[model samples]
Target: MPAVTADTLTLPRIAPPAPAAQQRPVRSVTTAPSGYEGEGFPVRRAFAGVSTADLDPFIHMDQMGEVEYAPGEPKGTPWHPHRGFETVTYIIDGIFEHQDSHGGGGEITDGDTQWMTAGSGILHIEKPPEHLVVSGGLFHGIQLWVNLPSANKFNPPRYQDIRGRQASLLSSDDGGALLRVIAGEVGEHKGPGSTFTPITLVHATISPGAQLRVPWRPDFNALAYVLAGNATVGTEARPVRKGQLALFGPGDALTLAAGTSQPAAEPNLEVLLLGGRPIREPVVQYGPFVMNTREEIMQALKDFQSGSFGVIPGERIPHT
Candidate 1:
């Protein structure tokens, strides 16, 4: 669970909510269902039951393993294709190697992020390095799919590798929580990752019994997903735990309080705070392609089948 950390006492403190600030209220809380992804790796389908309308600009998310893999047990995705969206992969406690047909490749470890925009179309693969495969350890991370609007659906493909240390660090007003802004703005601070759509992504660790309240954009839709431990969300204090996601109603600010106690193995409440300006456009998703219409999806298939997504490199790194 070591995505990013800082000594709260030394970090910039978030200003307390103003007296007139309207605290967001919880609209719904749903538990993510356990599932398996690429090569049998465990995952929690974080947006399984959420509506596409409520998750506008954000299509899907998977909370990848918090599991400790025995040597030779780690798994990763095979070569895949994507279009009309961006994939944001944040590694919290392990290493992941990514390679795309367009000559974008890199190794990202603890706290690092790989933001890939599969605009128009692209083929890529994500896997563990040979050494990690031979001597597997802990692996935990998040993979979020951010949808591009109709106008930008055919933009050029691109990639951004955001290192862990580049994240903007801040502290709760009371200095009881650490907030790592990985993308977008939080108050006057901004993260390193550049996004096509406006969005804010923050990973916060709240000490037991601590409270965190921060101003939120009224135009953006707010959501909080528990990565570890337990906590309560919204001004009404709705209970939420690991694998649960809380969606909030429109408001000026949001509030969260960690439970007084937690599992022995997880002593703090770890939450991923995310929100984005709604795209409010039609979304059509096929196996690996996301488009605005059935016709576009058919064209994407034809393009992929015709080798238009770029060819794999002649020399390849075999998966361990």
Candidate 2:
């Protein structure tokens, strides 16, 4: 849970919502089901039951392990291909290495973010460092897939390595919570990562019994996913807990409050607040490819099989 930490008293405070601002109401709250990803690493399918319409501009999300891995137990993804979307991987507690066929590679740890746009197409791999694999430790993070609109689906591939300290840090009005804006705008502050679609991604840690109310774009759809502990969402105070996601309805602002008590191991309420301007286009996905039509998906598969993505670097070890 130590993705990034700052003293709330020293951070810029998010202004309270105006009296007339409408607080977004909770439309639904669903629990994420546990699953495995990549080399059998644990994950929570964050958008499992949510409709694509409600998650427009965002295709998929996996809350990767909050698990403490024993020595020689850490694992990672094999070489894979992706197209028509951006993959945002935020490392919260451990080190993770990423390498793509286009010469973009790096090791990120503790709050760092790896933003990879698999526009057109690209081959990539994500794994633990050799040392981490030999001496395993805690690993926790989020992987979010943001869909590109039809027009920009074939743009050149790009990568952004956003350091944890580069995030825009802010505090709740009462200084009871810390907000790390990793992408998009939060009030007058902006984060480091850039995206093809307009979206706001914030990781907030709320002290027990604290409440957070912040302004949101009326045109964007809002969602809150709990990473740790219990919390209540919306003005109506609907209860939500770890692994649960709350979908919000249209409004000018959003509200969330931390419960007074939490699990001993998780003393605070950790939540990811994300919203994006809807793309509202037909989405057809097949395996690693996300496209606007079945024909486009077929073409993507053909392109990948034909070695159009790019060649793997000779120096790196290819994972199976």
lDDT of candidate 1 over 134-244, digit per residue (tens): 999999999999999888888989989899999999999999999999999877788888998999999999999999999988899999999999999988899999999
Each candidate: how many clashes? 0, 0
- The residue-by-residue lDDT of candidate 2 on 180-235, one tens digit each, is 99999877889888999999999999999999999999999999999999999999
- Backbone-clash count (model 1): 0
TM-scores for candidates 1 onward, in order? 0.97, 0.98
Model 2: what TM-score? 0.98
Off by over 4 Å in 1: 315-320
lDDT of each: 0.92, 0.94
Model 1 CA lDDT for position 226: 99
